[model samples]
Target: MPEYTTGKPWRLSAFPPLLWAVALLLTLSLAYAAQSGATYILIDDNLDTELAPPYALLQEGKALDYRSTTRVDRLMNGLPRNALRPGLQPLVGLMALFPPLEAYLLHELLVRLAGLLGMYLLLRRYGLPGPRLAALCAGLALAWAVLPAYTAYGVSVLGQPWVALALLNLRRGPGRWSDWLVLVVFAFWSSLVLAGMFVLAAAGLLLLRDTWRHRRIAWRPVLGLLVLGISYGVVEYPLVYSLLVKRQFVPHRLEFDYARLAPGGVGVGLASAGRYLLLGQYHAGLFLRAAPLLAAGLALAYAPAGAARRRLLRKLLAGVGVLVGVALFCGFYPQLIGVVQQTVPPLRAFNLSRFHFLTPLLWFGVLAFSLRHLPGPGLRAALVGLQLLLGLGMNTEWTLNVRRLLGRLPATEPTYAAYVAPELFRRIRQDVEARTGQQPARYRVACLGFAPAVASLNGFYTLDAYQNNYPLAYKHQFRELIAGELARSPELRTYFDAWGNRCYLFSAELGKNFRVAALPERAVAHWAFDARSFRRLGGRYVLSAARLLHPEASNLRLLGEYAAPGAYWHIWLYEVR
Candidate 1:
């Protein structure tokens, strides 16, 4: 057994298991309440396109045809076959067992519970003891449960707890061969982009610190970790290369506006950091309110003399160092951003604000560690109680805010709900089936002005898609097709952003010639409603909200119109002859 150095064993009695149970129950209750009377499948942002097809396939017990039906396939012309992380496939498979909504809820609940458990284990590994440890665990579990950062529709939330678990194990060092194996597996299974980056950052920092302290680099463990990371990469090389190299999907980029960078960018970044660290979101007043208490705690904790003060300062600095480093990269250095982008394209998506997620964990860890060193037991207990109160308050606020937002969601029939009305999709499918007398795979649907993602939800083989990982060849082909007189030198029509991301604009002449208006955002060379192009792409139906000049084109027949309450525009369905 490890020797207890900080306190008497009596004071460090085993924390009651009931405390953990209560914390978990509270967290689950909050999570369930937040989603009450609402669909578990969140349809925000890219989630509409990303998960809908997978969910549909899972329901049908059909293998994921990543190349044929998904948005990636639609946009990229089936190149790079699979774009999703392999880690997420297992969860999707598991969720397929139950009804879609129930499956989603169950998955979400399990992930949240796992996160709480991981955090509890992490705190225990940090040598925290007794009621204080129990309180901290409960508080953190509750806080994390309600935190907005974890509620997003991406894999980041799923990856977070695993990342924490990996960090905990990494900090303790591998005890055996089995431990090493688990670490490697967990690291790889965590979200490739978010958790992978966290592991790299944390491991690098810890290594640097250890080397600096010992005055020599530890080669064996480092090499072992490197081997594990490399092995994981080797296994996932296809997916990695597809996204990083072929797709050039730059999710995050440095906000290097000269006006924003100079004079006030640092201050703004700092303020943003503080907001994220405290409230996990942007609210000027919340930061202002919490700043004094945080400042007082740090000042009081570090005021004492001796080695303890130095240690506390070092812990505080470690957390601050990460935040500061990210801020510098994000706002202070444009040239450095360019260099990093060129060398490490995968890390381009490492935005400064994301470090906010890590900051609270570090700060809480430091605060928990420093509590034992306070002047007296009473003061220590008081500080811990205060932290628990603060955590509860923050969690309550977050829960209420989320509930309020969720309450605003349109209360429609279960089938025709969320981002795209299911009723509309069903009608479209029926129409197509009636027209063809069978649901054929070759028949493609195209959405011109409406979001293309709706096609995926309805199980339509679509000709339009909105995705970051668009195929280079397809993009070039589409650009050339739309180039008209500039077909020989299409670069003249293409525009590249500051980051060299290419986007093609349609000239007024092309719009006049094609008779297309109100093109969807991020359209292929701003192409919309070209009957010839649609026919060539095997498109049988076109859905649009825009006004087309020749609505009664000889080859096109208007099928129906649809409009749902709270929807922005009327949907017009046309069958191409």
Candidate 2:
């Protein structure tokens, strides 16, 4: 019907059975969330860093400020605005148009919807099972949609289905107009460094293989890929310009020592391999707990059916093998990178291990084969159902939201309101201003026992931050405050000196557990700091969630204790004396 598939065209005919199935599943998910409480949002990377910049830009009316001089001064003294993601992205720009909580929820739902639609269409266009097996294809698409991931990444991870469809379809010949449309939209929304660079590399290889095999260049597909690559270049103009034109600062990624950062033995490597192969990567969440069962089922079905099952079974096994290989490679990545870093000095920063991100998409495609040939329809249906349940159950955000809605949320899990209590921070700002006779703009503060992100969100200029990328010179400068602590513990030393993403105030007593709860007994007993160095950086105060045992020893004096009812953090404000 669509040139590639000599089967029925997948259109939503009248009642649309596939659409109903997807809708029912999505409704069940939403109903469960509604019952649980909907105020909660994923905090970890989403609220802390990713959401912060976009929300701040929206507040400041600088969402479109692409000026080189424009900086998100709230982060790392003054992190370049370009250092954050492009705010013009439709999903990201949602923050500018609505309240943060609403924006986050909307973003999450929209991406999932896009993912579902994209995956289902991709499956239909490609020769997957058949358009007739509505439930199986719809189920597969639904599973891919509700993955445990951050919406801050937009559709980059979930949008893989659309990306593959566009490329592969184009490679076959001149694909539909929708395929080209999909890629243009994808390029604008996707992250070049995270997924696009890898996509481009894969496309390059695909082109080479095609040329070698066909003995002729496939110009249409080549042009399609080039358009996608160029679109990425256009959208990520700031990032591209920084790389090519003017790099005022060195990226902290350059100093990454993977050997020290990720250390493990062969057993650990094998265990990691198992997780990656079966369970999937954490960021690109796919709980393929049912994958083993699927494999067993496929093998059993193939054992009885001779020649008919051979092609499908072999392809499935090969995909499994490739995924296992990827997992093993990921496990031993540090060792491999260590060798490469020494040989190719400049390429040290590039994280090639991200190829593992492709596993979920490949694995799902393998499942498409299994669905068609999996003997019994009842058994096939059960497999899809189990996969759905695993994905939903394991999803942290949904689970937490449900718990919060039911009022069974643990003290550890703060709701979105509790996490970013702007009123609490507003009070802190007022108290500090009244006490010091200086605005937050005049002074920089550091956080102990909690993330510096808390201070950053509250309009406080913070000295320490959880920046993924920043100037390496700043990292060296910040190390002065924690050099003694790093000397005390090798673990902390390796954590900061080698990895160093969270360039925050480190302590041996704290031991990298930044989320320090406010309890009477909880305090940093062995607190130490280079006060003069902190002062030189213009850090005037320490906004800690835990009290310092001997404040004077670290050249700090108690200013005030601040807290709001039902909030996560109880601040023990201190001045650098």
Global lDDT scores for all candidate models: 0.48, 0.76
Give, for candidate 1, the lowest lDDT window spanning 10 residues: 496-505
For residues 153-204, write the lDDT of model 1, one tens digit per residue: 3334433544445544554564456445644655444444544555566667
TM-scores of all candidate predictions against the true structure: 0.68, 0.92
Best by lDDT: 2
Predicted model with the maximum TM-score: 2
lDDT of 1 at 110: 58
When summed lDDT is taken over every stretch of 10 residues in candidate 2, the lowest stretch is 29-38
Cα deviation at 35, candidate 2, in Å, is: 12
> Which stretches of candidate 2 lie above 4 Å from their native place?
1-14, 25-38, 60-62, 127-131, 292-296, 299-305
Q: What is the lDDT of residue 475 in candidate 2?
A: 90
